[model samples]
Target: MNTSRLEAFSDGVFAVAITLLVLQFVVPDVQSGKLLAALLGQWPQLVTYTASFLTVGVIWVNHHTIFKGLRAVDRTIQFINLILLMFVVLVPYPTQLLGRYLNSGFNASVAAAFYGVS
Candidate 1:
């Protein structure tokens, strides 16, 4: 019935999800003179990474706030929280997809939609 364990587990999931977002950013292989240009080329990934990071951060804060108000967590609540954690864990995948296809015409739209749905 205690919420502490649930909150702690949720916090761990959030931390892992946020950490995974950064793994999407692979260092671009480029010559010294073209480093700036190479980095600039990955603007889409950077944008997606930032968006996903902020999204996870905001969700974590909100989850903490909501859990604080609950005196106890029931089985129903635990199941719902698991569902939420499932989605939280999935964030990085869609983020990577969106970033890779964000500028690729129709795929960009698909990726955006997928990102939104996720």
Candidate 2:
């Protein structure tokens, strides 16, 4: 197959992964007066969402850049690209975990590390 086919597939995966990131933002249950505070308190989720969104965007751009000059792709290249996409697809899961546990004292480190590894 052509490189364009691989790029297209990767693009779709990136789109889905980034789209899933936003699902982490839950509507807060709070009284009228405290709504703002509740929203503000979700800073961790917001931070993770922003970071993950930007990271995925950058990765997608870079992926395109790397493929721009390639004349053809071999089995090894296709396999490597699949591995990269595997990690890319896992981004949302770690992002959600990080957002959910980032503020937890000891758990924060682990969550951050998990996000970093992904």
Candidate 3:
């Protein structure tokens, strides 16, 4: 019922989610001459990764602030927190999708919408 346990669990989930965001970035394979171009081609991935990372960071901060004002968490609060964490963990999937399809013409808009919904 204490906020401590909830905060600790939420922090762990946030840490894991943020860490998983980096897994989407694979090193580009290219010859020395083409390395620059190959790396540049992954702009979408970089953009999505940065955006998701910052969003998670902000969420974590806000979560901490909210918990700080509460003495204890009730059952309803716990369930709502669980739902929020579920969406937090689901972030990487949308981030990956958006990054992969951001420059794919028609799929770009779909991916953006999916990411927004997520």
Candidate 4:
């Protein structure tokens, strides 16, 4: 198997996941005078976005570092990389869930745990 294609696919998945993170943030509707307050209330979304973005960045960096030392791609190596990429691609799902349920009591904890696990 060619490492080039695998690397390209992994890069595409990372890019898409990062792009999806911003899509979770919707504009807050509020009275004209309360715009600042409404924006301030979105701290959870902002925090999650920042955290996920950094996490993906670190993953990409590490992926590059790991692949750089590899002599060639093999079935076992490809399978391991696929597993890592699978989790990388799933990051946004939990991030979106956490953002949506961050203030919903029990659901918030569950979402946070899900995000933590992912």
Report the backbone clash tally of model 3.
0
Query: Candidate 4, residues 44-87: lDDT per residue as tens digits?
Result: 89989999999999999999888777667998988888898889
How far is each candidate from the true structure, as Cα RMSD in Å? 0.8, 1.2, 0.8, 1.5
Give the TM-scores of the predictions, in the order they appear: 0.97, 0.93, 0.96, 0.89
Poorly placed runs, candidate 2 (over 4 Å) = none
Report every candidate's CA lDDT. Answer: 0.95, 0.91, 0.96, 0.89
Ranking by TM-score: 1, 3, 2, 4
lDDT (Cα, 0-100) at 78 in candidate 3: 96
Better of 2 and 3 by lDDT: 3
lDDT of 3: 0.96
Off by over 4 Å in 4: none
Each candidate's clash count:
0, 0, 0, 0
| Per-residue lDDT value at 77 in model 3 | 99
Candidates sorted on lDDT, descending: 3, 1, 2, 4
Could you tell me which residue pairs clash in candidate 2? none
The weakest ten consecutive residues by lDDT in model 1 span 23-32
Q: Write the per-residue lDDT of candidate 2 for residues 5-98, one digit (tens) a residue.
A: 8888889999999999999999988887999999988999999999999999999999999999887899999999999988888889999999
lDDT tens digits, residues 7-118, model 3? 9999999999999999998998788799889889999999999999999999999999999999999999999999999999999999999999998999999999999999
**Candidate 4, position 5, lDDT:** 80
TM-score winner between candidates 1 and 4:
1
